[model samples]
Target chain A: MVAESARENKRVLEVKNLKLHYLTSQGAVKAVDDISFCLNRGETLGIVGESGCGKTTTAVALMMMPSPPGKIVGGQILIEGKDIVPMTETQIRKQIRWEKISMVFQGAMNCLTPVYTIGKQMMETLREHREMAKEEAIARIEKYLAYVGLSRDVLKRYPHELSGGMKQRIVIAMALFLEPKIILCDEPTTALDVVVQAQIINLLKDLKQQLDLSFIFITHDLATEAEVSDRLMVMYGGKIAEIGTNEQIYGKQGPMHPYTQRLLKATPLLHEKVEELAFIPGRPPDLLNPPKGCKFHDRCNVVMDRCKEEEPDLREVEPDHFVSCWRCRES
Target chain B: MSENIFEAKNLQKWFPVRRSITDLLKRRQSYVKAVDGVTFSIRRGEIFGLVGESGCGKTTTGKMLMKLLEPTGGQMLLDGQDVTHITAERLKTYRREVQMVFQDPYASMNPRFRIRDVLEEPLLIHKVGEDHQERLKMVARALTEVRLQPPEEYMERFPHMLSGGQRQRAATARSLILNPKFIVADEPVSMIDLSTRAEILHMMKQVQRELQLTYLYITHDLSTARYFTDTIAVMYLGRIVEMGDPDDVIDHPRHPYTMALIAAVCEPVSGKVNRIKDVPIKGEVPSAQNIPRGCRFHPRCLYAKEECWTQIEPELEIVEGRHWVACRRYKEI
Candidate 1:
């Protein structure tokens, strides 16, 4: 959460001239193109986008999760004034992972062992990173379980025995056991029920305040993101289309980017149920052979000649509110 | 006589405890009540939603309705015929008439089977059509019925070739080939993207209208179920806490569980931050193994009084017209 609170301090993470490319057989798919941002300590930076928008890929890069077709060809991830890209995988895993920075992954259910009990699994996590005796590890596990509102008895049960919400709690407990500086939550509450999702969201908020950790919450669901995130960064086709505070992103009448607006409108809510939400009108641009100029230009309704001919750069119109669009004429 | 296409009068399906090390010594086998005294009827040509959280017995209830699972006690009637104990000819008839559409579209369709093979397997199993060419024509009709058009293109392609939405449509087409009277759609569109969700939902609606089909849509998501289903039965820990018109349950929830569910989805009107405690209720779902005393939701329920803890399970009573809600606090609401 330090990365989140650093807004007042000026810089927690400064990514200057960032460029992530996927070295596929087809071609080098430029995902994160010259993206730059600073996440203050204890602040949430919500990277909202459609699937395959390089939002998730960027997170993986931040965690340095193995470069397959994807490679961070150029970028600098300065967390608490330290560069991560140049660091070795082993060093990142030892020093940075879970201790310095941790993440709650999307489609992350596989992280939990199906055979092991939630508590036992949690105890194992504590035992691994922290040099605690079995007794002390068990005590800490129980404390974290209680914090997430799961009983110590639940730790004895298998992963399959517990519900999705329960398993997610264990993951959260694991994320917090070491007290990481920045927590990257990738669609953390996607599969769970709404009621349960609320509980998880609240738990994150409470944990953030108590831990004073930074969160780079990655999610497609705008409603949940808006509820938790302090600031928002909208990514499209491997680029930051828009960036601003939470109120600026959600509280606005509409989004500056067409993609952002489509996502906001597409989701169905309880009270504001409309017939057929206006979609962006096309699938997400193919990473391989992506549309030239603006990746979203193919589907963007308010398209312009410049948008098709030249890619839009991230430009600041208002203070702290950054957007990328050739036709970003709205003041 | 106009019979309820599906009826469960006092239906209960409690899984008996197996003989274990402790159980063998104690000789007191504990039964896990998966579906306790669920009573509801799906009318012909109506979309009925069965919604609940995981392990709340919504899937179990649907499985029982599909006759994939036998009931521990009570009976199931399909068009005045008792199906709970059917065997031989009657069982085959019931199987042919009723079908199920599972949640995972990818798993539901056999990866090895082509789209044509997938849709035709049901027909081949039931021996519905006389000739192969005749069956092919019917498959085309089924695909068209589900709005999966230019049927020939989809027919030859394997399950892997199809997108999530298309594969789900193929799944619907497969179920439709049987010409079943009732279909239990267990969260059919939950796995797909939000953009294509509407098309699948609308297709289901269109198919239901054309085929005059009755559906038991089991899902945990309520926001879209409000727009999709006609009636909804909200389940909590193997029992229907509230059952009513979608509008009533979605808007005016009688049970606290249902209320909390609504509050969970309902965004704050004032745009002020959402509080977890203001979540209309509290606490995660209790373990299915050790259910809470009195009402299953009582442990988390805000209005849980002393009487709520000791009382036997509440009956599903008609709190209002066609709306059956089982709660001690229904009167207070």
Candidate 2:
């Protein structure tokens, strides 16, 4: 069914049974285990989880930087149905890294070289990935900068001279300069203030519409995920708990996965006033030695005998909505 | 009748920027007016939130309130008595009444010391308890109050042993150990994850009600402010652009800056993606050292007029019931 849907819409990226494990001295830390998803063209899929749930690790693995001590133990990452997991470093660096897919790193404003001018840093990406000449790269940078609301004079200024918002916009412009089909934005507006964060969100939306870009926006903020995402994936202990449209996940169709419901309740939504926020008790399970069955069973309010003994599989409960809870399945 | 427990009358903190050798050669002096003339009051047990983006002096204001940093101008009163320039002997009394909880949970507590020693140090300094047994009881009580139950289990653990949420709760326990009447909680929950934020906030509110403690809740997140604060003051470039009830100020804001801030919050509910139609203000907040002349927010204000440019800076004036705004054309806008 998923493959049929993928063929109907132009699937930009697809991951099947992807597993990433860190070779720690204690044990193999299953950071991302058996996760699968497909991103349609021009669609935004938001991956949200608490810290240590492997959201960022998945982004890093997708970037092809499964560093030493960390390895992709299983599964295929196909970009336009072409598996890039087996591709060598040189092949990935030359053909896949920036030309096909790129990333706007988390806290990326700090990644810019303080000594170099904005133009130089941006030009380096264009010349490296696209192999554009000096004048052409400069012109391209200027145009992209304008698209993100930066002036021409900003090209001459150093990283320290510009504000945080300006620096973030410059980083985004560099990411889109290659015209990549897929962009992995890992918490792009985490450190920025509210109004400035809005600007970056608006800019991303506009650029996505204009370029027909597919995005995997990774954030711990559920509200922000709802703003830009067509579908939302909730991950817990390196496994997906639930995946659905924004409406279905926000209690529109009644009960969801207990973890998802608790998360939506815990998050302070804009303009919504509540007497008290519902907090999910217990810490996220340790990845090194996970629980026997459902990772969230210990913290889940509705845990049953079956939940503690058998792991739930991700199954479609409704149209395009998948959940991994026995209770949800029974309902 | 509600009584004001703490009041700040136009507090100011101006730090002189050290002139570079090259700039000194040109004979120029500059100062970053970090907290310029901020004023607010906390009732006996209500939470007065000081909210703004970074560099807006909310942290500096909290520090000034805690007496950790002395203000360059203005006066502070505790129970109708001036505490700003109180004598050293009297300042000790003020310290007992007012305490602070820092933002970074890891850095706030001494890592080497166990949680028991950390909580007991404040009692030792103020000589609150007569004997070691008494201090231990007080520390255990504080721990239980913060919901770190079976306090004995956590007393011997170091800061590194606890999770971010646990460390923050321990920090809150440390603040409560002093039995302070007022606490300056500076971005206390911003360092923690969303899953743990609600618990910390709920604990804080519970403790406030039980202890009758006033809070100077400082944070950059408006949503948290709305959920936590009774009244909020929105700061912008070293000045408070708006101050009123959190619901009123956040929902029906008069100032353009406040409107922009409310618009910026991303609601998780669907169909509200394009709710914020126009960018109320243009560009990031200007440098505090070079605040615009007429209205500090005018240069970026969408409703800015000719008077907003050439006239003197607008003073904060009350336009409605308990709602104060600093824009000259606030009424018309």
The lDDT of each candidate is 0.80, 0.88
- Against the true structure, whose TM-score is highest? 2
Give the poorly placed runs of model 2, Cα more than 4 Å off. Answer: A1-9, B20-27, B86-91, B273-277
Instruction: Give the alpha carbon lDDT tens digit for every residue of A180-259 in model 1.
Output: 77888999988788887887888888877777778889987676777777788988777888997766767745567777
Top candidate on lDDT is 2
Per-residue lDDT of model 1, residues B225-324, tens digit only? 8778889999988888999888878777888888888877734222434344368786677766677878788888898888788997777788789777
lDDT of 2 by residue, A1-331 (tens): 7668646468888899999999989999999999998888888899999999999989888889988799999999999788999999999998888778999899999999999998888877688777677888888888888888888899899999999999999988888887788999999999999888988888888888887888899999998987888788999999989989777776466338899888888989658788898899889998999999999999999999999999999998887699999998886
Candidate 1, A7: how far from true, in Å? 5.6
Model 2 error, position A235 (Å): 0.6
* Fnat by candidate, in order: 0.24, 0.64
